[model samples]
Target: MSYVDGYVLPVPKSNIEKYREIATKAGKIWREHGALEYRECVADDVKSGEVTSFPQAVKLKDDETVIFSYIVFESRQHRDEVNAKVMSDPRLNDMMDPKSMPFDGKRMFWGGFSPIVEL
Candidate 1:
């Protein structure tokens, strides 16, 4: 089964373009290092639900939107290997510093998940 890493974050609407640029660069680096798929999606029709919703999960406000993304790998071992290389690659290392990140790193949440089914 394929391994996956999912991410959710809050980004300022005013910085969507800049965020997209950064994501594009990072996505390219990940792809080059062996990620099978890298995708990013911004909130389009998201709205507040009576119970809970994506916006609520990230405490999104009027000026902010959510960025949902994921990276696909052949397997957990492959993901580990690729991430190690990606982390050490000079072209990507500089972006690891939260202070220099294009988006609010503190507002980002991510996790690795074991696929239960794929069909």
Candidate 2:
């Protein structure tokens, strides 16, 4: 089974373009380091639900929206190896700063998932 890392977060409407630019660079780096896929998606039809939903996951604000993204890896070990290289890559230096981010890092949520089932 593949390993995955998921991320959901809010980005100011005005920062969407900049966010895409950053994500593009990061995605390339991840793929080069062995990630099977690095996908990013902006909320297209998110709506509030009874308890919690994608909209609520990032505490969607009036001026901001959610970005749901994921990265697929061959396995946990591959993820660790690839990420270590991506993190150390000089090409990603500018992205390491919170101030340069298009979204609020404080509100971002992410985690690695071990695949239990996959068809």
Candidate 3:
């Protein structure tokens, strides 16, 4: 089994390019640090639900779009190790500041998962 970290956030539509630039750099860093896979996806057809949905989950606005991202690791231990290195990496300094992020930090949500099935 593998461990995964997933995230959902709302980014300003105008900042999509900026967000992609940042994610690209981050994915490369994670891969270098041993992440099995790193993926970032933008919403193409997500819609608000009556009770809950990607848009509602991130309090998405008309000028914003949802970003769904994930990083996969060999295991929880590996994830922790990779994340520790990532956090300490000087290349991530600018990205460490919440105020300087491309999206609202308060609105983003993330969690670690234990895969229940692989095939």
Largest TM-score belongs to which candidate? Answer: 3
What residue runs in model 2 are displaced by over 4 Å at the alpha carbon?
A: none
Q: Model 1: per-residue lDDT, tens digit, 1-119?
A: 99999998888899899889888999999999999999999999988898988888888878999999999999999999999998888987676787777577777889999899999
Give candidate 1's error at residue 22 in angstroms: 1.0
Which residue pairs in model 3 clash with each other? Answer: none
In angstroms, how far off is 97's CA in candidate 1? 2.7
lDDT of 2 by residue, 1-119 (tens): 89999999999999999999999999999999999999999999989999999878778889998999999999999999999999999999999799899999988999999999999
The global C-alpha lDDT for each of the candidates, from Candidate 1 onward, is 0.89, 0.94, 0.95
Cα displacement (Å) at residue 52, model 1: 2.8
The per-residue C-alpha lDDT of model 3 at residue 41 equals 99
Q: Model 3 segments beyond 4 Å from truth?
A: none
Candidate number that wins on lDDT, 1 or 3 = 3
**Candidates in order: C-alpha RMSD to true structure:** 1.4, 1.0, 0.7
Residue range with the least summed lDDT across 10 consecutive positions in model 1? 93-102
The per-residue C-alpha lDDT of model 1 at residue 86 equals 87
Deviation (Å) of 48 in candidate 1: 2.1
Tens digit of lDDT per residue, candidate 3, span 36-106? 99999999989899999999999899999999999999999999999999988899899778888989989
Flag clash pairs in model 2.
none
- Full-model lDDT, candidate 3: 0.95
